[model samples]
Target: MKHKKYQITCPYCDSPALFRPASMVHGSSVLEKGRYLYICSRWPACDSYVAAHKKGKRPMGTLANKELRHKRMLAHRALEELQQSMHMEKWAVYLWLQGHLHLNEEQAHIGLFSEQMCEQVISLCRQLIRTSTGTTA
Candidate 1:
């Protein structure tokens, strides 16, 4: 069976973002050359983009602005810290988080999360870390 291409949209502007090579994304800026992403056609004005998988056209997440991107990064770091301290497989961590967030397997991705959801993940992971370490707030 043929798979459908992922559709990406700018969460901020609600505009249709297009998938293109990173080289064509920002008119010769330094942005991890050779990668691909879905970028808003409005570009610098819209300031939203979503990275695609290294080898495919599939988007890793919804399009994000600078703030959302930073939150996502923080959420990822928190998850990483929790995973390391708990000595759990990444998938196991994801499964637990998905259950906590009440998301289905296919819909439970940090990258696809909104800024609020990212913050929730970070907060929950910090709590998990403290609980696992037997430390009290």
Candidate 2:
């Protein structure tokens, strides 16, 4: 899968910064979650690194329908398979995979099986919740 690249402006320098995939760090706890490491294209000149955040939507609010549930279940199953094949934890894999899916912060958080997987799980779960609720995530 191809990972998406993000273009961010440095808060301090305001230079055009390109973010590239770096590595993953194990989270602090089961709930704390892990993060993605992004390296600045500018490298030593810029020395910028950014981490992605995990965001999730509540299951009760907008996702209380049926269609969303189906979609979420499918995504969950796919993620589970990927995790099993990779032999890694679910949350981390979800987070890494969410980027390829173009999921927003909230959606990404729901798909997670753990804190590290929060973002991916949230994204996937929101879709599931939405499908079940007959809405969109």
Candidate 3:
């Protein structure tokens, strides 16, 4: 499918931004009315994000900023919860690896949890949890 591009400003750094068509999902359009996702060109450093729509593209001044704020809050809360859960699981796994798996000191040190790997494990856990609970993590 063809996608459009837009020039935007990074919400965090106010730098020039670009929104290229990434993908299209089946359920809903990510770039639909009242919604937009623009990524900063200087990614992995700037890490800026803007979740807003273009002028005249959506109902002027009628966008639910409050609802958007609430959704952001919920998303942040969910992320925090997931982080905590993942931390606990990581510690448990570390302990298990050290105790039950009987890894030596050097092996245990090498097997120490990396945040990136833990994040992947946490993502998997989130998927499983969502599949079972029918809720977002």
Candidate 4:
């Protein structure tokens, strides 16, 4: 296994988290995969979870529910698009986000973003993309 499990708390329901195989959360299709999860004990009802880090017994970030998870993914994709379209390095893009979004280095991580913050980042990314591509429309 790549990662070990650790206890965490779910932000949504304030429930303690449980360490389980990814299959438990993602279903049996992922049973053979070597990933772990920290899920809310009140799952199904609370529906919050986070993936573990590959190298250690730590979570990737604070546990979030499905809606926040989707927003995070979209926010991450927006950052990726910015990196490619602007020909910026990953660190450079993060620095750019920190500046444009008024976030500190720690708060700039997409995993820690709120839905509104994710939307703000997406908008900034779009602006950068349009500016770099020289296509306002």
User: Best candidate, TM-score-wise?
Assistant: 4
The local lDDT score (0 to 100) that residue 117 gets in candidate 2 is 47
How far residue 60's Cα lies from its native spot in candidate 1, in Å, is 0.8
RMSD of 2: 14.9
List TM-score per model, in order. 0.85, 0.32, 0.26, 0.87
Q: Write the per-residue lDDT of candidate 3 for residues 18-133, one digit (tens) a residue.
A: 55322211125654544544546665366544443454322111112233334444533444554465555645544543563366545443213233333444454466446655
lDDT of 2: 0.46
Candidate 2 Cα outliers beyond 4 Å, as residue runs: 1-61, 102-106, 110-137
Off by over 4 Å in 3: 1-6, 22-36, 51-137
Per residue, candidate 1 scores C-alpha lDDT tens digits across 10-118 of 7788788987877775566666677888999888799889888876577898888989989999999999999999999999999999989999998888779999999
Considering lDDT, where higher is better, how would the candidates rank from best to worst? 1, 4, 2, 3
The candidate maximizing lDDT is: 1
lDDT of 3 at 130: 69
lDDT of 2 by residue, 5-103 (tens): 455554435665443333322335454343334434455465544444432211211211133434455656666755665566976775675675666
Residue 80 local lDDT, model 2:
75
What's the lDDT for all of these models? 0.86, 0.46, 0.43, 0.84
Clashing pairs in 3: none
Q: Count residue pairs with overlapping backbones in model 3.
A: 0
